[model samples]
Target: MSYDKDDKRTHLELIQNVVTRMASNSFAIKGWTITLVAALMALSAASGTAKLFFFIAYVPLLAFWILDGYFLSLEKIYRKIYDYVAKDKITNEEYFSLNMTLYISRYNQIENNKYSGFKHVVDACITKTIFPFYIGLTVLVSVVFTLAL
Candidate 1:
C-alpha cells in the first residue's frame, strides 16, 4: 500500500472511530449493569428473593466490569496504532496489515504506552468513574441483602 498523507489521516480517523465505539460499548455495559442491579433489587425486596437475586447480581457486575476493561484496552491499543501511523513511524504496509497483537506483544517498547488487557482491568479497578460506580453498586447490593437477612 502506498502511503499518502491523506491516507494516514483517514486511517487515524477510522481508529478514533473504533475507539469511540468502544467507549460507547462501555457506557452500554454500565447501563445494563445498573438495570440488572435495579431489577434484582426490586425482586429481592418485593418477592422475598433477596438471597438469589443478590447472588446473581454479582454475575452481571463482574462480567460487564471485565468486558468494559477489555474494550478500553482495545481502544488504547488502537490509539497507539493511530499515533504511529499519523506520525509516519511505520510504512503503509505495516500500518495497513498491522497485527492487532502488535500492541500487546511489544507493549513496553512503545513510549508512554501501557495498553494491556490486564493493565486496563487494574486501571478500571482504580479509575474514579469505573471503580467507584461498580464498587458502590456491589456494596449496596451486599448491604441491602445482609440487612434483609
Candidate 2:
C-alpha cells in the first residue's frame, strides 16, 4: 500500500471528486423527493381524495427525509476525508481503508450529546430550502386531511 508521490496525488484528486459527487447526490435526492411529494399533492387535490393519500404521502416524506439526512451525513463524512487527506498527506493504504461509518459514529456522538435522535433528524432536515418545502406540503396535507374528514 505504499504510494509514490504521483500515486498519492492521484488518490487525493479522486477523493476530492468523491466529495463533490456526494454533495451533488444530496441535492439531487432532495429535488426528487420534493417533486414526488408535489405530484402526490396534485393528484390528491385533483381526485378529491386527499385523506386516502395522506398516509401514502407520509411514506415518501418520511423515507426521503431519512434518505436526505443519510446523504448529508455522507457528504459531511467525505468532507472530513478530504480534510484528512489534505492535512495529513494520507498514504494510499490509509486512503483505501477509509470507512464512512467512522465519521458517522463520531457525528452521532456529538449530536446525541446535545439532542435526541428525532430532534437531530428534524433539525437536519429543517435547513432553509428543505424546511420550507416540507412545511408547505404539511400544510397541504393538513388541509386535505381535514377536508377529507
Candidate 3:
C-alpha cells in the first residue's frame, strides 16, 4: 500500500492507544499552571509589594507570564486534538503513530520521506519539561530585576 494509506492505518491505531494518556497529561499541565499562578500571587502579597498597585509585580519573578500561557495553550490544544481523534470526530489518519519502528520498516518501500511526522502529538510532554526550564530562567531574571529596583 501507499505511504499515506499506511500512515492512516498507523494513526488510527495510535489514537486508540495514546488518547487517554494525552488527556491526563493536559490536565496535569493545567493543574501546574493554576498552582504557579496562585503561588506567584501569594509571593507578591508576602513581599509587601501589594502596597503598590502592582500587587503581583513579582509575577515575572515567578513566571514569564506570556510564555507560560503559550505552553499551556499548546498543551490544551494537544489534548483537544487527542480527544477529537479518540472520538473519531477529527478522523485525520495522519495524527496517529503505531510505531516508529514500523515506519522504519516501511521507509525503504516509500518513494520519499514526506511521511516523516513531527511527533507534535507528543510535543506537549516535551514542553512539560521545557516550560519549567524557561520558567526558572525567567523567574531568576525577574528576581534580579526586582532586586535592582
Best model number under TM-score: 1
Sorted on lDDT, best first, the list reads 1, 2, 3
Report the C-alpha displacement of residue 22, candidate 2, in angstroms.
1.8
Give the higher-TM-score candidate: 2 or 3: 2
Ranking by TM-score: 1, 2, 3
Error of 3 at 100 (Å): 3.3
TM-score of each: 0.83, 0.68, 0.33
| Predicted candidate 3 versus true structure: per-residue lDDT over 1-31, tens digit per residue | 3346566556556644454554455456556
What lDDT is reached at residue 63 by model 3?
44
Candidate 2 per-residue C-alpha lDDT over 1-149 given as tens digits, one digit per residue, 9 for 90 to 100: 56666766775687777778867886887788778877887888788677767778888877877777666655556776666666664544465545655544654575574324455555667777467766786787777677766
Instruction: Tell me the tens digit of each residue's lDDT in model 1 across 1-149.
Output: 57787877777777778879988998998899899888888888888677888788899988888887777667667787777667677744466544667544554565665555676666755667677888888898888889987
Q: Which residue ranges in model 3 land beyond 4 Å of their true spot?
A: 1-15, 48-98, 104-111, 114-149
- Candidate 2: segments with Cα more than 4 A from true spot: 89-92, 101-123, 126-136, 143-149
TM-score of the candidate numbered 1? Answer: 0.83
Residue pairs clashing in model 3 are 11-96
